[model samples]
Target: MTEPVVIGSERSEVGLPAAMEILLSGGSALDAVETALRRCEDNLEDHYVGTGGLPNARGEVELDASIMIGSSRAFGAVAALKGYPNPISVARAVLEKLPQHALLVGEGAAFFAQECGFATADLLTDEARRLWREALGPSVESVEGENTAAGAGDEAYRAASLELVRRLAPHDGPWGTINVLALDRSGELVVGVSTSGYPYKYPGRVGDSAIAGAGNYCDLRYGGAACTGRGELSMRAIGARAVVERLALGDDPESACAAMLTDAATLPDEFRAELRTLALTFDGRHGGAAGQVGSVYALMTATSAEPEFRARRVV
Candidate 1:
């Protein structure tokens, strides 16, 4: 029997442990990811995800979240919602409620989150307040620039590009993305992704975190993945799922991930930016693994022959 596997951004005092809890409880990938992200929502780092993410220029906390189930090709997503601490749950709700393939922004999404039993409190916390204050002064322009792009050239790229600026505005410290890939005890393949909106972002803009195959993807017959780093860069580039597709073609997870990064470098200047990282985990014929999560964006994999996880950095 293939052993169950779980992979995520890093071992946060909250996220990693939450994943373990789900795994230990015999939960599937869906449960694992939901549990992990929920834990993150409650932790001090809550500023980046759930209800605590930075608002878009309008000063609203619009959130985005998506989930993919490999077996059914059933995907769910929610964009630009406030009052929902865990947008993933709301995304799942959208998929379950609709007869079609997708959903979009506004009260429809927020109404859905409320129906799913989500609770909301004042989003700004003491930690986040301090973060914003400390980033005041010269950093203010950078932060505000990310929040609003009134002069931003075009509408098509406005939302995503603004998020990138917001993510980069805070030079306060480096942060990690939360990712998880796993096959449940029942043998279902699931992928989950969650992140706070970019820092200093306008209140309502949604990042790649809510986009499937960009932030994360899963294939029961093949493998699964999740990513971290600059969402705009990864989303426009289709980085994480591309790596998994390579693995399906018999490339080991490590090589497949490297291949994806290599291809990104060839893209024209219109696509290059600060390096984003991808953390992929799969239940290979060999076993489960936690991919590389590093500064320069990396990938990792595991196979049945060697259950141990291996990682390699890619620029």
Candidate 2:
């Protein structure tokens, strides 16, 4: 039996302990991944995911999440999902109940979540609304017309969202999805990621977090990988899947993660920004890396008292 382990983003500090509980109890990686991410989603202070996350220019909290099972390479993802606090659970449900589809977005994803008996909540917290209001300034009043923010197809809202998308550095921070990757006692590998995406982004702009092989990938034969930071870099490089492919071809954890960033660097400078990754092998080896220096990730084992912060290699 392989030793159980959990690895994730820096913000996953809110989740590691809960995930460890599931792993130490001899639970499956799938369960651990879901539990970990759900815990993070409930952290109202994080402001980068779930309830307190920053909103799009229209002042909406659109979320994205994905889950993958290594053994069978099963995958499910949702993008631009509003009103759901635990998108990871919804993603997992999609994996189990809709194997024929790989992704769901917008109204379809929300409808499916309702079918799954998931409760809807106002994902926007007071803090999030404050941030959105501060970010939008006076223009928010004009952009948020009488029509509901969700249903507003007014040209003013569209133009405002586009303007915000153009002016802001899409990757203003080094943060992205909270990736929760777990290796179960039975040796199964599962990777999950959740995020509200770039702050004040264009409405309906889906990032890498919602794409399986881009932001996350897994295969029991090798392991699993997840990306954070700049989601576009992962999407462009197919970073998560590339990391797993390298591991399958005999690369070490560190080298595999570094190569994933290198693959991302091949993108034209205009398209590139920050990209970070966490990798775990089926045999239990793990590491993290980033396109920028001084970045860090979190790791915890069944025997660990707490998650360890590791400096990510700059590649």
Candidate number achieving the greatest TM-score relative to the actual structure: 2
State residue 174's C-alpha deviation in candidate 2, in Å. Answer: 6.8
Off by over 4 Å in 2: 144-161, 170-174, 269-271
lDDT, residue 191, candidate 2:
95
Model 2 lDDT, residue 69, Cα: 93
- Report the C-alpha lDDT of model 2 over 1-315, residue by residue, as the tens digit: 889999888789889888889988998899999999999999987778888888887788999999999999999999999999999999999999999998999999999999999999999999788867776666666654465546454665667668766666533443567998899899899999999998888789999988878999999999899999788878888989999999989998889999988878878866456788999999888898986667888889977999898888888
Model 1: residues with Cα > 4 Å off, grouped in runs: 11-13, 136-168, 269-272, 275-282, 285-312
Error of 1 at 59 (Å): 4.0
lDDT of each: 0.59, 0.86
Q: Clashing residue pairs in candidate 2, if any?
A: none
The TM-score of candidate 1 is: 0.76
Q: Tally clashes: model 2.
A: 0
